[model samples]
Target chain A: MVEAHSKIISFASYIPENYVPIDDFAAPADMPSKLDLNRITGLEGHRRSKENEGTLELALQAATKCIERSKVDVADIDLVINCAVGSLCSELRSKLSPSLANLIAEKLGIKGAECFDVSNACSGMVTSLMIADSMIKTGQINYALIVAGEHITALVDEARTNNLWFKSKALASLTLGDGSGAYLIGKSELPNQLVFSEPFTLARFNKLCVGEASKNRPGPMMRTKAAQLQQGVMGNLGEFFIRSMKYMDLDWEAIDHVYSHPTSPRAVKKGAGIAENTVGKIKRLHNESQDIANTASTSHCMLLEKSVQLNQLKSGESVILVSFGSGVAMLAMHFYLPEGIEQWS
Target chain B: MVVVRAWKSSSEKTTNLLKTICNLTQNLLSENGISFDDIGVIIHAGVYRRNFRTEPAFATHIQGDLKLKCGPVTQESNHCFSFDVSDGSCSPYVALNVASHMLRIKPEKYCLITIGDERPNKQSNWPYQPITCVMLVALEGAGYQLTGTNFDSSAFDSSTYVEMIFDSAKSANVIGESSSAAQINSDNSKFSGDTNWLSGRHIHAFLSQFTEGTTNTHEIIDQSGKTVTATWV
Candidate 1:
């Protein structure tokens, strides 16, 4: 009914109540300055969902908050999509029916909406956004609920049992935490447009990072070639950023905020810095990801939610959201706050 | 509008699956006179390995392996966004629905879906053993039309295909074929005892309606113990 761009009507994010201070990490005694872990990874503490908490609960919690704040009638939600890294149902026996999206919609009491899940590793949320954006711009549905609940801490906890340091090659999975995020996107006019959303596949380096469950492990485990991943991100970050900004007709100065989806590793943080430098000075930086750690698919949305909570965004200001993940793929999108709209938590 | 072009592959390793997916997708596009530049998005659907490989989203490899290098004519616009839709056999159906809306959205001219997977070794309800199959579904206007789709969410049935369908008769109109051309559908229906029924039978059966394949349908009882026929045409 409005402009073709999908304007975010509401945002909500949640980190589990259980807190895991970096000091609590099961690092070896000689694990080289446990206190410096925060300095190295830009994380002081992170949250981890308890055993009783399933991925679906994390998603439901976040979605509840989003729908409450969105104030939109449940019947009006035309789509529900889950872009999480892992399955919400821990036990995916044989049946794959009743998708996560449908489950979420049912929980939220939103019927008659198309439902599905799109998994794209860390960049899944935005990728889902791109998909919803396409559908919305085409007049398929007005309101699309996109959410992701990640228990990446499961990967870290798995490593902690034995050889975590050796397996991750020294402090991998340090910045990962448990969290979920939700966004309600709808059509809006020009000044409130969702500018450019692009995802480019760089699969040559897909092997650098992978998530899987081994024969002995029942949950997701991440094995990464940390060095190689950093090298790849850094080598391509600057060039891609400049070209993207130029293509979007945006100046680094015009962007009121840069929500760089940091992966929580020191090398990645450095690469992020290099990425920012290549784009000149970002007007304001949303780096809460350091404290929250990396939440995989939900990281970018978490960053945006935190910015809204802190009132870092304003109406009509330019913002850039960037995500790079397991697919060795990168999604960059530009958007501005709608007129007269205030940040909502 | 429907399954204008299709390809199927079967393999054990993820690498082979990706290879098969890439080949099948490219073949479909080329056969349809579609270029890499014409596609704005690629939707991939399938489960990870038996254990569920979560990271490095497989679509990345599938997209990367395509090697869509920029041509001299257009360097800026050739890039297409690719992502994965994971849920099991139901993923391709959902991906196609998402693609339908996306294609109708201007700027997205074509949608390519690549699906393939092998049955996990330990699943008890698997009707077919060591089954792996791949299919490339490309949809564009003025082609075969996807009438609609339905899923028996009541439960998962190994012997039945009941998710998405292309009913030749249900479609409002047919381009150069008979009113009943080919209809392909998938769902977790009852898994008939036939080994061939588990993998790519829907594709073959649907194609048989128009081409040179045999038509075979099986009726198997579902989790509810009700007999439901899994058909191909």
Candidate 2:
């Protein structure tokens, strides 16, 4: 018998068709008129979620694509992990029980699969992957589907309709967009198919951002110390990147493509510079935020799916994913795109 | 094999959620001759949170409050990884499965998991009293070694369920509107549990049996008829 390694068999992402232009947002009287949302967020517009659509629906859409691409029977899937931070369902109500994972499995007609939900802000997908990878290596399960559907723009709506102080505090919410992503992970004997560095949380910066229900409305809201969060993440980039490389035992130049947290184009560009200064230059660092802005937890996979559709990624090439979430949860994953990558296109 | 070294819990409501978890964690670590630095991972599992709060994992707050090695992960420094597992009543078992695999790869390192839930705020309606439970699991330990865990999730069993509902008057997501279709009594495979409280009460029952040295296996079934069963020494 061969030792098992978790490999990404298939992956897909979903972005809503509705695009909302930045100009559509009316600046609150209290917001500094000079605060340039475009230049700061590096976003021209973002995807708007359809009415009555929520996390479960978006996740199912992406999960369907991922499963279809895998060519594997749904009955063979033994695990389901939902990593959506915004777990809204049923009239956009924040769901607390019957976890999004269980609900997703039910909707997909997947039976007898172990299911659960993970919340680590935007690093959720990668964090859930770590668990699935560990379980596979331990001979616990055969296949696991890691999924996330972030119905995140409710925070944007909350910030838009609220008062002055609320708008200022929730400014980062403006960059949020709705999206979903899914990865079908299964056992493999090949090397470099999937590898993860130990995830760390710099909880000292935990208070830099927060998301909760609206004080004066019926939906979600977010407040962020945007500058401070960026500074903290960028300041630690050198060490995080170096450690990730070391753990995966990859030469800096071995990486072909890099996908980061996708908070903003400026932040990704700056953080990439800091990482390169500490290590070496990346071959291609992807920042697909201009049209869709930050898609929260689904950002990296969404970018990966886009890269595939554009023919930018070649089969058997090494790609690395780096992510940092609001909990200050951080991790990096290195993997090789499986054969038949062009099929996803 | 990974084992449960020690456990502690609190439900007095003397303080907020994070503080309660940290207090229990501190006591569990001290009593078991462990330290904050000894922990390699922390997983918080529950359903409800204060203010419907999302973003930072509640475990991060606990790790920060306990002053664990909450530093950047680097070659020269020690660090602790923390995240949250939200599986309603099945969280502890799910977290246990994840931690078991993690500890198996990193021999001798320990993982601390905290489980609990609370109403978001005062204006919001709360269904049950808030309670927090902490468990220390590790590979090189002398306690009940976890042998295995299995999960059976087939359908959407709404017999027992809960979801956030907006109270127009309060303008908040509260637990008041959340409902459980029916109460579940213990049988052979599933453990009896309260519909209002989350995993803390189920854990309490499991601990009671463990204390009496009567049961070697425990099971938790969520409102969805999904069940996770774990056997120990």
Candidate 3:
């Protein structure tokens, strides 16, 4: 039997303060600021970096906040994994994750920490948790910090102007936002009450949704047509829910909360049918914080943190977090909020 | 039956260098009657030409030529002597890992291709650094088949010999030449040209430690168009 090893000690999210209405931001005629776009999408507002700030800067800010709130010593951090959809390094030739890891370590005064980046589109946070859990269980590392930061708004224009789908499905343009979310996972001697159960992927649908543009000018471009996007969502959402249910031996009613990839209102409603959630246990932040829609993998983490802050979820409650990315990659993991950690929310 | 091809050192544009190496790789694949699409996945590994800041250093260059529908790309950057010298390995791994997940295969099934061309200007970042890039491809299915293995390096001093050759060439080439040549010479002089100097010493030191007192020498030719030979003393 797979053993449960690590528990999330603390979590935090950062969004810029500015807010923009959804209609104002999504209008093709208007050029909305990042703050406005994030606000309209119902994201708490993505943390905006100075014009000169890059991926590492945004990541550092969010990570520092999580660390500070946790009051955990910097030296105690054994590993850091930065999961972002956009390029994080000034030098694409080197590992952007480790570079950011090094920067965070230096700033936090953490010595002898292993730092790297993980990219799996929307499923990045869940994947990072799996990796950290394995490492902790195997005794490779004691504490692992998973941080995801994205500025997809920067890529939205190119995606909308160049891609046919974004032009047609204008609603999606509003769904893409910017923000960062972080979680601290550490080994707990206490019995693992809530552990990462299992992870499965539907790779055949990997390319169904993605963000890419021209080769020379990199930006967010929707590769899959809108039809494929619909099909992918319909096809994989069922597969993910069914597989997760079978693996966990959970019925639809057993799931206490549904933390879904906040793609759109329609998509979320459709997803409700797949997960069999007749009750309104589904807590969504995508529409509430348009500023940070589809923060890629960080979306789930940010949403979870928000749910906690809103006092919507409680300890001992089972939460199912599902993430879907462009490659049509789908990931589902079951988790529970530990006892004391709920107070921070 | 498979053949092995190696591009040791070169003076060429980064794209050209990559094209040449990939061309050689394609030739090997074609001669074996293998189609590019049938190959499934390609892994590019190495620690050279970590200069470009925007384009994915590996996939961006090869995607057009290979006509690859969609696959992963990754590199090994930890081996760099310094930050300036090391290319990031994680970016490439992201691409490769995604491809692997899509194809539903192990890391060993994919074919890995590593190519690097360190120029004189890049020496400050340790160009010509001895880095290993590997490509793994599975023709039969997902699993990789390992037929033979060998790791010995004690017979020849690659570092000392490389330094001698580079030092002699630099001293000889320093004499009068054209304006462009002079400019190249000046640039080379700035970073202590002789790209192979530092690399040679490092390789020798590594070999000495790796082989200990044993006489290390080995060679192998594989069906996957890969040939590896090493000796250290």
Q: What share of the true interface contacts does each candidate keep?
A: 0.45, 0.81, 0.01
Maximum-TM-score candidate = 2
Candidate 2 colliding pairs: B51-B120
Estimate, for each residue in A175-219, the C-alpha lDDT of model 2 and write its tens digit: 888989999988887865899876778888888899887776676
Ordered from best to worst DockQ, the candidate numbers read: 2, 1, 3
What TM-score would you give candidate 1 relative to the actual structure? 0.79
For candidate 2, the per-residue lDDT at B208 reads: 56
Task: Return the top candidate by lDDT.
Answer: 2
Q: Scoring model 3 with DockQ, what do you get?
A: 0.05
Give per-residue CA lDDT, model 1, range A93-185, as digits (tens). 111332467667767777667677787788888778877877787676799999988877867766676654455542566668888998888
Query: In model 3, what is the error at residue A124, expressed in angstroms?
Result: 1.9
Model 1, residue A24: distance off in Å is 0.9
Enumerate clash totals for all models, in the order shown.
14, 1, 49
User: What Cα-based lDDT does every candidate model obtain?
Assistant: 0.61, 0.80, 0.46
TM-score to native of every candidate shown:
0.79, 0.95, 0.60
Candidate 2 CAPRI level: medium
**Cα distance off (Å), candidate 2, residue B167:** 1.2
